[model samples]
Target: MADTTQDYTPGSHPDLPPPSSEVGVIGWLRHNLFATPLDWALTILAVYLIYVLVVPALDWMLFSADWAGETRDDCSREGACWVFARVWSKVFIYGRYPVEELWRVNLTFIIQFVGLAALMIPGVPYKKWTGIFLLIPYPIIAFFLLYGGAFGLEPVETSLWGGLMVTLVIAEVGIVASLPIGIVLALGRRSKMPIIRAICVAFIELWRGVPLITVLFMASVMFPLFMPEGVNFDKLLRALIGVAMFSAAYMAEVVRGGLQAIPKGQYEAAQALGLSYPKVMTFIVLPQALKLVIPGIVNTFIGLFKDTTLVLIIGLFDLLGVVQLAATNPDWLGFAVEGYVVAAVGFWIFCFAMSRYSMYMERKLETGHKR
Candidate 1:
């Protein structure tokens, strides 16, 4: 009978073995790029194609490009007209806004940058308060600053706002305003009340069914017809509202998907402890749902940002709009490539930053992997 009971203790290990050489950087390149004859052939062909395309472009843009020029005449046909970029950089960034008032844009951007960075950093304190300020007082302050009628600042019409400033405002407002509205709409769509469900469903479907460009056109053109004859709204403001509403519809769908992913037990458990619907959602359900749908939310955000370029159609001079205008200027004629390249780079940087941040948050919030 001695030692009949099995020893149940599992042994613990002190160290993780280093990954084999076959899994290191060199090994990774070998496995992914050059593992077999066909892989090697494809890799070589790809690299050769890349070099053929990239080297000449690099040479033209960098080594042979005009670095200093006074006018289009100074630019050589053989290389990139970099001088155009240098001269019009400010115009690209600030649009046709009065150069003297550029500091206001700078100030707004700096405040937004610092505030958003602080909020995004994991360990920063007072985030809830910061968010409150952003949603509440921040918009009022920004509106006055950007469209000043009081505080001794001369009023600048929304028509004067353009370039990166216009782009950022449209995008940021859409993002901040859409999230909470989307959540409410998502919850309403799932509500037990028939009227609430129908309204939410109709709202979401109506917006989502239409193209955003149509919404913008309506905001720019038809929206005025609906308003009182004397009363008016800023064109930019109208565009912002249109963009936010359109984005919220898509976001509601994303949020609804996340809400549905939540387990029935979560709802039942929340109810068993005497939690109300709002309490159950705010404390237990929403956090998990939002966490699950971060990728979709970020995708919507990126699409929303890119969609801001369409503001050009409505006569707003966003970054791309300004670039198009600048490319046709007498002094910078035929430099559409230069202007387009700069705009493409700017857009890529912003979109790439957002995508990377989403990935970081996803990894940070990951709870368990499905087997």
Candidate 2:
């Protein structure tokens, strides 16, 4: 060392430090969950709560469950009687939809799915018109399939329709039908003509002010009074009308927000370019407005989907109604939990996927605007 070797000094090297025992998983747990007495207590309580919930669920649903059987009687254990679900699944999904005509529903589903997928694809030519066609013809084809008197197919009354299938059909139709109606109402509300604005405001406020159940009641009972005699509509159609009208009012407000969000300069610029009002709106304004309100539109749709459950209250056998029916069956008694779980899972999956897609579209359209 005296000859030229440098003396080693602690903390002299910037990169060197004492080894830390407080930087790994143990350290993280200690800092986050056990750093203080209160933190440790809360963490233990949360763990116990989770265990209480999760363990029982796992035991009933998996460990002690009976899944394969022809009847609820086959399930002899003190656990989830999933055999009820297994036996009655078809009825739950299709209601009394005639085993032979099940394929029609499947076909409609395929067509709708393909159409929606096409609509979602980027850079597709004539996408707007394609979407419009998809939205318009869906109800017609679905109607024919579900309520078949055409092409020699037996007419299946809407009263017999139920399960997830009906829920989807109602939700889709409500969303599709409401969009144009809502857009028009929104535009009318913002129109320069005082009469048009007043009319639009009156319609929107009248609808938005009332509960959906009351509107549904009016549709079921009062709507026929308004219509000429011998021009009867199906109960399902009446429900659809109620849902669409109610949704349109809310959607109009949403679209109005989007319209207001667009800069006034855009309108002036479109006018300066000699674009007529309709062209300015269709090409320049509505697209931007709709893009801004995609989330709201999706939310409206989710609400409509959930509201379809209300059809049960009106004696329509939709998904919830069918589940309730199944629950009340003497053969499948005490399976309310299972039936509701199935319905809830189905609704959750649909609403969750739609909400996620709306968020994605918001980001995507934002990118388009930036470009």
Candidate 3:
């Protein structure tokens, strides 16, 4: 009955050694990159290729690139003209928007950023109120501020809006509007009611079957013809509607995939607990379904964001459109590569940030071990 448990000493195990770079870095490299002579050779080859590609790209971007000098002549023929992208930054951001009225756009972005930050915080009190402000009142206020038909503010036409402002607006509005619309469509598609299910199926199929360009074209040309005489719609409004509808169709399919992934047992369990169909769906199925499909939803959003540039084909001057327009300027001749590179970099940053967020959300919500 005396102490039978052996006193264990630290570092007593002979099988395991204290961790070091060899077991960590070297071990990983050996297994992943240089386990065999062929792997080592391939790894060396890859390094050589990266260096070969990156050095020239870096030289073109920085070492030999023009950082200053107003005229195109100041730019080195051997490297990029970064100064062009710098000087046209405002044009990229605001498109054709009047410089004097840029305060309106700035204010709208400030409000939106602040509101979204507050909403994302789990500890925020009065979330319902915050949602009301962000969803309802904020849009109305932003609209008046942007359009400026009231309170002695000069009215700015939608045609005047361009650049990153229009791109972001189209993306944001399309994503926000599509989510609920998609949810409804998904639910309807899954419903027991024959009429509801059939209607949802047809609607989803019709929209999904058509390419987005066709939808945009229809919105720009055909929508006007369908409208009553003297009932005019803003071009931006038409594009926004088109983007939203096209996105909603894709989102509906993504959400339905998530919904379909939910187990039958889960539905049965919810129903057995005296829950109606709505309660079961809302409280049990949907939360899990949406969580499961966060990546899909984000991918859809990123695609929609990138596709906002397509509106330029219909006369809207989104960020890419502005760049194209700038290329035509006599003063800024022959700088298309600089403009396209900057635009591509801008897009890559936004899309990369979104992909990182999706990964973070997936990790944060993970409930089980991944194999």
* Per-prediction TM-score: 0.89, 0.91, 0.88
Q: What does candidate 2's lDDT look like per residue over 1-371, in tens digits?
A: 35865666976845655346477787788888899999989999999998999889888878888887887678966778888877778877888888988998888888888778888878767888877778677678777877899988799888778888889888888988899999999999999999999999999999999988998899899988999988898898899999999999999999999999999999999999999999999999999999889999999999988988998888887788888999999877789988887788889999999999999888877855643
Residue 50 miss distance in model 1 (angstroms): 0.7
Error of 3 at 153 (Å): 2.2
In model 3, the runs with Cα more than 4 Å from the true position are 1-32, 121-128, 369-371
Q: Cα lDDT for residue 255, model 3?
A: 99
Q: Over the full model, what C-alpha lDDT does candidate 1 score relative to the true structure?
A: 0.89
Error of 2 at 253 (Å): 0.9
Ranking by TM-score: 2, 1, 3
Task: Say which candidate scores most in TM-score.
Answer: 2
lDDT of each: 0.89, 0.88, 0.90
Worst 10 residues of 1 by lDDT: 5-14
Clashing residue pairs found in predicted model 3: none
> What tens digits encode model 3's per-residue C-alpha lDDT throughout 55-152?
89999888988898777777877899987888888999988788999999999989998898787667888888888898889988888888899998
Q: How many backbone clashes does candidate 3 have?
A: 0
Better of 2 and 3 by TM-score: 2
Error of 1 at 25 (Å): 9.7
